[model samples]
Target: MTIPAATASFHGIWPALLTPLKPDLGIDLHRFGLHARALVHAKGCGGVVPFGTTGEGPSFSVDERRDAVDALVGEGVPASQILVSTSCAALPDTLALTRHALAIGAHGCLMMPPFFLKGVSDQGVIDCYRQVIDGAADDRLRLYLYHIPQVSGVGLSRKVVETLKRLYPQTIVGIKDSSGDTAHTLALADAFNETLMVTAGHEPDLPELARRGSTGAVSGLANFMPHVVQRLAGRPDAPNTPHDVSRVRLLLAMLGPYALTPALKGIMAALSGEPGWLRVRAPLVALTTDQMHTLQHALKPIALDVDVD
Candidate 1:
């Protein structure tokens, strides 16, 4: 079978969307749909990535993730614009979610290597992905290798990427480098920019990557600040590059002191004036009162408007 070239339509800012929850910590499908629609139709984001790291992907089970994707589509968020993060610690779960995303006609899937074991060989990583591609057995599969070593403990090496691309070129279409290392990201772009869609998950790196033909991001900051991320990814030389870069850095700095996902949720609570946004699954608690107050004060300087309805 002839492998087509990487997709051109995957370019632009796709927010790693925040998963809103109810007071009981159930997935709030109503608010979730609203946010997805707002990000694409109103905020000018290229699309939204749900159940990603920022969205607490692993915290939710396979069924919850599938149902939310269905609700998002039912509520008018086009499946073609959504990049579903179908990674799971177990191979069976990963295969199930990947098949579901393909069945729904999502633009693609963002999958990390099997993360339960650390320091696995490159061949082990390759074998893991091969199982998924072969098990999915779907010609429509368009996958982005998700590289976030700090979080996943297993990273995709250059050689591993090359081997997989060689074997499954059609299914392996792109890479999302959340390595948080500027040089590594640029290196991936340098090496694979011709044959793959290389996108940054680190917001500050957007300008530099954009200069090298990477015009997309799966950004956590875009959850509340989509326009800013979109502008940064547009062009490295855009006059507002410095300002946008600084703004993202400042906001990200606020997340440094707290658990990242909760800190982001706290900000969302403030932005939307809905305290329910503070709810997180177990093992991840909501921000404290003082923390919320501090976050609100920190955000006051940026004057961010609430774009999600």
Candidate 2:
């Protein structure tokens, strides 16, 4: 399938980076920059997404997030390459974050509907975004609706997306459907196609989604497996290498035994040999000793060169 010129611009792997924490649990800005830089330079990533779900976005204060973005851009990562997820439950915070991203010349903002109020009316969802768009009052802002009902408890209905696009045609550019439902993913791709950039959050569907007109990914796994994702994103017609499928299987195996964030941090620690990499904020703890041992054992096989010691 021919990718639209607009969609093609954003097509490639954008890793949802893991925010490495200091031993005192402070934001490790230097380590964060290193990670983001490595992804772009070494892993050949399209861009880096800071303060998304995998980066523990909700756990940090606005200042912390702002500082992290500062660190990333300060490291010479272009604003055109950084897509910031500014999806706060509060309308004011969301606006503030998005405004900051735009002010810094970020490529765009990935926003989730106000997810604090469960069972919100469709109009309520629409109004929340409307307030931000109108409040921010920036024509330069490119907004991508983030759909991850499983995590956010707020789903981006097709009607909501269509309405936003109809109202703010140029501003509303895309949707990140992390719904992880293939049927829903296909439905969104079929409905929006070139009109709106539909990036699949489900990594495995990337190849098929690419074939069906979906453009790129804002993937968590891409943080650790950027080259694997690069290969996966190569072309829809290409076959999945054995390495790709096995790597994905290895990641999935970790999910059942631990929370994804901690597991990912644990794996990152194994790769970087930095114990502080395992620290997480309150309400999210480090992996258990047994889990770490097991994760190291399991990861060694998949990440052959990584020192799991």
Per-model tally of clashing residue pairs: 0, 0
What lDDT would candidate 1 get against the real structure?
0.88
Q: What are the models' TM-scores?
A: 0.96, 0.94
Candidate 2 accuracy as TM-score: 0.94
lDDT scores of the candidates, listed in order: 0.88, 0.81
Tell how far residue 288 is off in model 2, in angstroms: 1.9
Candidate 2 minimal-lDDT segment of 10 residues: 300-309
Worst 10 residues of 1 by lDDT: 1-10
Residue-wise C-alpha lDDT for candidate 2, range 169-240, written one tens digit per residue: 888888888888989988998998768888877777777777776657888878777767766656766565
